[model samples]
Each structure stands twice: as C-alpha cells, then as structure tokens.
Target: MNNFKPYYAVIFTSTQATDIKGYLVMAEKMENLAKQQKGYLGMDSARNEVGITISYWESLEAIKNWKANTAHLFAQQKGREQWYNWYNVRICKVEREYEFTLE
Candidate 1:
C-alpha cells in the first residue's frame, strides 16, 4: 500500500547515547503502537552515525495524539533520560512524493 494524498510527516533525527540498553526494544514497541494509531499511514527508518525515522500521518491532529500517547510519552522520557544525546523532531506537510525502483 502507498499514500499519494497530501499528508503529514514527522521527521525524527537523533544521536544515540553510549548506553542504550533497552532503546531498541522500546523503539520497536513504539513502531508497533504507531501502526495501530488512527491516522498512521507508514514509516521509514535508518540508522548509521545519525538515526532518522520518518513517520507518516494523515493529519496534524493525528501526530499530536501520538505525541500525547501514554506509552509514547514514556518512550520520550526514556529517550531523553537514557537513550539519546540529542534529537530533533520536525513536522511537515508532505504535498508530493516520487520514487524510482530497480527490480
């Protein structure tokens, strides 16, 4: 499935702390929870020296709801307290998208 309509994208960029023991588990949990949310459309993630995760949403309200979710709030706290050294979140309207694939 794909979204061709106008939507919202939450871009999360971060650098990890040296001690991130439970971070991966919590991240996976959050991903699953996000999939179950009201306006969740899709997500893409990659990590190298810097981690970037873009979560697609149907609307700004949906994004706000996710940010306010209990479990997500806990994750956010954990991220600040233990997992991330620095992070930035940007919410933008995605008005257009295009891709090329080689199969």
Candidate 2:
C-alpha cells in the first residue's frame, strides 16, 4: 500500500434484502471500478445481515470521481430502486493511523 501524510476514508453502510438481485455483479463492478480510479488506495467489504465497505482515496477529488463515475451512478440508482433498503455514506479525513501485522 502507498503511504501518505493525509488521505480520506469513505465508509458505506447498507442494509440489503436477502433477495440481493444482481447485487453480486454490481458489487464486483464497483470494487473493480474503484481500483481503476485515480486516487484509490484500497477497500474492504463484508456482508452479513448488513454490508459495509470502507474505501480509501488520496483526496476528495478522487472520491468524487468514484462517486460520479457513470457505472457507479447507475449502481446507485439501482440501489435506490431495488437493491438496498437503506444506506448511508460518510467521509472522514484521516489525521493519523497505525496498524500491526504478524507474519
């Protein structure tokens, strides 16, 4: 992963029906598309009764680019129309962060 003094984290929380309906395809597309974005850092997602995805980017501009992406826009519309019962998006600047890993 790239290191930076400052960056952004986009947290997406969603409650979805078990019905799902094309969600897997769309979700995969979103992840792959996000990586292709200019300021993308990385992302992780998990699904249970609810789903959460935390994506990182270099700047607000990069985040905006991902949000405004045509395919992503379509998915958003579809989410509103059929996929998600409810969802929330929050963006925060990371002032500091640390992690530890053992291998």
Candidate 3:
C-alpha cells in the first residue's frame, strides 16, 4: 500500500541495553497490538547496533492514542528501565513519497 497523501509517521530510534531480556517478545506484542488500532496504516522496523521503527497512521490523534495505550505505556516503561540505553521519538507529517521496486 503506497500512501501518498498526508499521514503521520512515528519514528522511534533507539539503542538497546546489553541485557535485553523479553525485549523481542514485547516488541512483537507491540507490533501486533498496533495492527489492531484504528487508523494504523503500516509499520517498518530494523535493528542492528541501533534500532529504528516507523509506524504510519492516518492522523495525529491516532498517534496520540497509540502513545497512551496501556500496553504500550508498559512497554515504554520497560524500555526506559531495562531495554533501551537511549531512545528518541519523532512524529512527523508525511506530505509526499516516492518509491521504485523491481520484482
């Protein structure tokens, strides 16, 4: 789904702590829960020494709702307490996009 119109992107960038117990499980759970939320468009993520996750939504209100979700709040706390060494979140409006693919 190529969404070209205006939308919201929640960009989460982080560096993980060494002892990442249950981190992957919680990450997966959060992704699954995000899929069930209203206005959720899509998500992309990758991790190496640093991790980046960008979730797309239809509106700012949608993003705010996701941020305030109870389960996500727990995950945020866990990330601060144990999982992440440091993290940053940026919410932006995507006004336009372009892509190319070979298949």
RMSD to the hidden true structure, all candidates: 2.3, 2.4, 2.2
Q: How do the residues 1-103 of candidate 3 rate in per-residue lDDT, one tens digit apiece?
A: 7645799999999999999999999999999999999999999999999899999999999998999999999999999999999999999998988789999
Top candidate (lDDT): 1
lDDT of 1 at 52: 100
TM-score of 3: 0.95
Clashing pairs in 3: none
* Model 2 residue 39 lDDT score: 93
Question: What TM-score would each prediction reach against the true structure?
Answer: 0.95, 0.91, 0.95
Cα lDDT tens digits for candidate 1, 1-103:
8757899999999999999999999999999999999999999999989999999999999999999999999999999999999999999999998989999
Candidate 3 backbone overlaps, count: 0
The regions of model 1 sitting more than 4 angstroms off are 1-3
Whole-model alpha-carbon lDDT for candidate 2: 0.91
lDDT winner between 2 and 3, please give it: 3
> What number of clashing residue pairs does each candidate have, in the order they appear?
0, 0, 0
